[model samples]
Target: MQLQTIVPIKPLGNPINYKAKIVNIGSCFAVNMAQRLQYYQFQNTINPLGILFHPEAISRLLEFVVNDKVFTQEDVFQHNEIWSCFDAHSDLNQLEQEDIIEQLNSKICRFKANVFDATHIILTFGTAWVYRNKQSNQIVANCHKVPQNQFEKELLAVETCLENLKKIEQNLRQINPNIQIIYTISPVRHIKDGFVENQRSKAHLIAALHEYLEKNKPLNYYFPSYELLMDELRDYRFFGKDLIHPNDLAVDYIWQKFVETCIHSNEIPTMKMVDEVQKGLVHRSFNPYSDAHQQFLDKLAQKIDVLLEQYPFMNFR
Candidate 1:
């Protein structure tokens, strides 16, 4: 009867609903959850600066948004003939200096706009280990394939992680005092850092995050994403071929748990309806001109029209 241990999750005080303005940031796992939110047609924005893996990188992003920092030629550099910014993920890189600068500034503007009105902000931290550029004496978000000799690898201390967490909260609250923050530690393991090293990194992040939550209380909520994967779904089957990232099935299971705890009960019907429409949209008709297929298309169109009528923000196209 008790084959597995469940990670008991409590219902959120201010659970997300159709009306909630959501913005997700941090690790690639955050993108997983954001994909689910997007599928359900929720008002969600994700990773404008791209996938930031550590707390300090996230803090730097928030600092840029809060301080209205402008990007210039000096902020970006060329490596392997591709221009990149040390403060952002490679997803934002471009072929020219002006293009990258413009892209970064544009994304920052978008992030600032969304965050100022965001009701719920989700942050997922991937590691405490970071690469500090020896020349700049600063931690970079992404190394961008730079030579390893140019950077110093170091583990961020618990105190520094805690400080970054607090600063993130303070900065967000300053922009939108009513914003509720949800924090989760990424479940993906960085085995390249070495097995023991990865464990130490996660421990530091977990300790610092919990300490910050315990001290600050309700402005922040901790979701045990790490525990759920490592404990509840403790099987190799739940992981991708890399044996690091959670597979699609595991992400679906975790997302279901997230819905049960963090999403509003009233929105379940809408979510189900959205799921149906999504599946119907992708359904293939074996016969191109069959009456049955036409009827199915009609039903799908009706569902889309109804949802769009109720939630104008939703786009089935």
Candidate 2:
């Protein structure tokens, strides 16, 4: 008898090889996956505008980048000595408004380049609930600790999600005709939205995402990350202290499942070698002048040299 339910994930037609350039955008989970890809030294960019959680915010940001929409003074507001932009996350907030504008535009340049050049784009949507600034009537990526009354919180309609997906598809494909998009609903639960509301929000996302996939069959795909957490893990132990986010162990499990499903089989050996080099780089030496430690450093350098020779674009730093 089986003790656990397994999720059968089909490999993509065009696998991610060393040559594949990737960009991961959207929620914190996207950052989690991108860090793993970074560990293996894959050519990729992660959350250039920082961790955007909603489909509309991500959709708007992508549209801005592809259209070369630059941020200006009118776009940001000063809050408690820090300047913040509704278009981006708090990570871009700065002491000066001018500094924030410059930072936002610089990140946009990189995001635009990655949008055009990436072979694979992974987007993780964390919520369908969005907060719109009452004054501007625009969905804000983050509230930045502003008072609740300043914004109106509403669940994004299914049609609205569908529209954003179409906008993302149209804008991206217009530039990078061959780009492949992998959509994952983040496993992080928004319990603060209330239990029933959280389920309703996820329901909207799942329906909209699947509808988009069914209609636009060519370029989009979905990985059942939420399902994996809900079905396979199915325990409070898989959650962190807050109980809203997947714990490190759960994230690692999902990542390993992701590798087996999405990553090319041919690259596994390279991944193993990269892992060895990474572990060696972090290994602590008991004696700074010891011969054994010196030999270990030499071997680590040799492995790095071999990888560099094979993939000239890869850098350990």
Candidate 2, residues 268-317: lDDT per residue as tens digits?
99999999999988888889699999998999999999999999988787
Instruction: Report how far off residue 86 is in candidate 1 (Å).
Output: 0.4
Residue range with the least summed lDDT across 10 consecutive positions in model 1 = 211-220
Clashes of each: 0, 0
TM-score of each: 0.99, 0.98
Point out where model 2 deviates above 4 Å. none
Q: Candidate 1: misplaced stretches above 4 Å?
A: none
* lDDT for predicted candidate 2 compared with the true structure: 0.90
lDDT by residue for model 1 (1-317), tens: 89999999988899999999999999999999999999999999999989999999999999999999999988999999999999999999899899999999999998999999999999999999999999899999999999999999999999999999988998898789989999999999999999999999999999999989888887689899999999999999999999999999999999999999999999999999999999998888899699999999999999999999999999988
In model 2, what is the error at residue 1, expressed in angstroms?
2.6
Error of 2 at 235 (Å): 1.2
Q: What TM-score would candidate 1 get against the native?
A: 0.99
Give residue 170's lDDT in candidate 1 (0 to 100).
Answer: 84
Q: List the residue pairs that clash in candidate 2.
A: none
